[model samples]
Target: MQLIESISKRHSPRSFDNKGIEQEKIELLIEAASWAPSAFNNQPWRFYVAEKNKNPEFYNNALNCLVDFNKSWAQTAPVLIITVVKTTYDHNNEANKFALHDLGLAIGNMMNQATVLNLFMHQMAGIKFDKFNKLLNLPQNMEPVSIIALGYLGKIEDLPAEIQKVENEKKRVRKPIEDILNYSPLK
Candidate 1:
């Protein structure tokens, strides 16, 4: 798919079908993430993935990390992924101020790649930090970022009433460039 088309198609779908994604497709998404640029060439992003059928324990663990609202709908997805980043540069052991930004870029790349692969991803920031760290036994230096639920889109009618309204009204909306862009100081 063209870049613009992929961007236009991308959406945070809350419901998913039961079908499993091919391992090769998942690998391509990760590969896209790996190609994202990082500050000082410190590729700090890390991804932990779990499939419901392949590993129930792991999938359930990932599901438990989400906030209650997300848990309700995101549970239907076939794959769950947790993204983290090393907090500091390895060689110097100094704080990497751009680590989170780099991780965000990686996720953006993955999202577009998923669109290109005819898949969908819904990313959430409402994660239980302590629970996630404990469940995964993450290193002290690694910081959890977000959880992503992936699969093919399911019926929007299955979503909660409020969410269904939003999806039905206008699935996508964004601030116009004129409204968001500014070069001069405000009066």
Candidate 2:
């Protein structure tokens, strides 16, 4: 699919099918994330993938970390992907300002790739940080940034009323290019 078309079609789908996603496909999605650009090539992102059926307890625990509204639909996604950023780059390196930005790029790549694969993805920030960190056994330096729920698409009817309302009115909304870009005259 073209980039523009994919961008338009891609959305945060809250409802997902129960059918399992192929392991290979999941790997491909991760591969897509791996190629995303990083600051000084630090490659600080790490993904923790949990297949729902295979690890129900872990999945439930992760889901429980989410806000009640997000939990309502997130539980149905076949896979839960926890995105983390490694705070340290090297033994002496203390600054990692771009870690989250790099992770965001990787996630954008993953979401776009999912759209091309006819899959659905939703990045969620509504989570209990402390609980998620402990449940996933993440080190102190590895901060969890977001949770991505992945699976095949499901009917909008499956979503809660509040979510369904948002989904129904969804359309690509963005700021004008001129508004986003500034071309200052030389001083």
Candidate 3:
């Protein structure tokens, strides 16, 4: 079975070259994200970008917000983005349960765009949200969810021996369709 080239080539790579991404490419990625479907067209996704070349202070601060493990590798990337979700709907001012899912869709679009641009992206859940929240002075309704490191692919040898070994050894895998796709709920 063949998949879309961008979709098939999209895999999280920890090693990243320090080359800076072009501003136009970044804008295009964000534009692609904006095109994603949102519940009620709320468009609740907000991105905080820190580019090593354009915003070194913000880049360093965003890097510090990552957990130690992620920071170790993510520091090599030239671009860092924090994906924030608006917890409330814009029109109704009510809690939105689909905001997180909407954010995921937006990120999916961004990831595909990155792949199309021949850039690599690694999304990490391990972030120090407290520090990030304080750094951004985020309001109660806006919650930081994930941080992404984006850049060109780097030499695997650049990573720590343990990570390099894991990177070399691991292959992308998925559960069988029977295990994942079900018409009925599990008992």
Q: What does candidate 2's lDDT look like per residue over 73-168, in tens digits?
A: 888799999889988775457879888999999888888889999998988999887787787777777888888899999888988888889778
Candidate 1 lands at a TM-score of 0.91
Question: lDDT by residue for model 1 over 103-138, one digit each (tens)?
Answer: 999999999899988899999888887897787788
RMSD value for candidate 3? 1.3
The C-alpha stretches of model 3 lying farther than 4 A from their native spots are 185-187
TM-scores, each model vs. reference: 0.91, 0.89, 0.95
**Pairs with backbone N, CA or C atoms under 3 Å apart (clashes), candidate 3:** none
Candidate ranking under lDDT, highest first, comes to 3, 1, 2
| Leading candidate by lDDT | 3
Q: Which pairs of residues collide in candidate 1?
A: none
Clashes of each: 0, 0, 0
Give the candidate number with the greatest TM-score. Answer: 3
Q: Of the pair 1 and 2, which is ahead by lDDT? A: 1
Cα lDDT, all candidates: 0.89, 0.86, 0.92
RMSD of each: 2.3, 2.4, 1.3
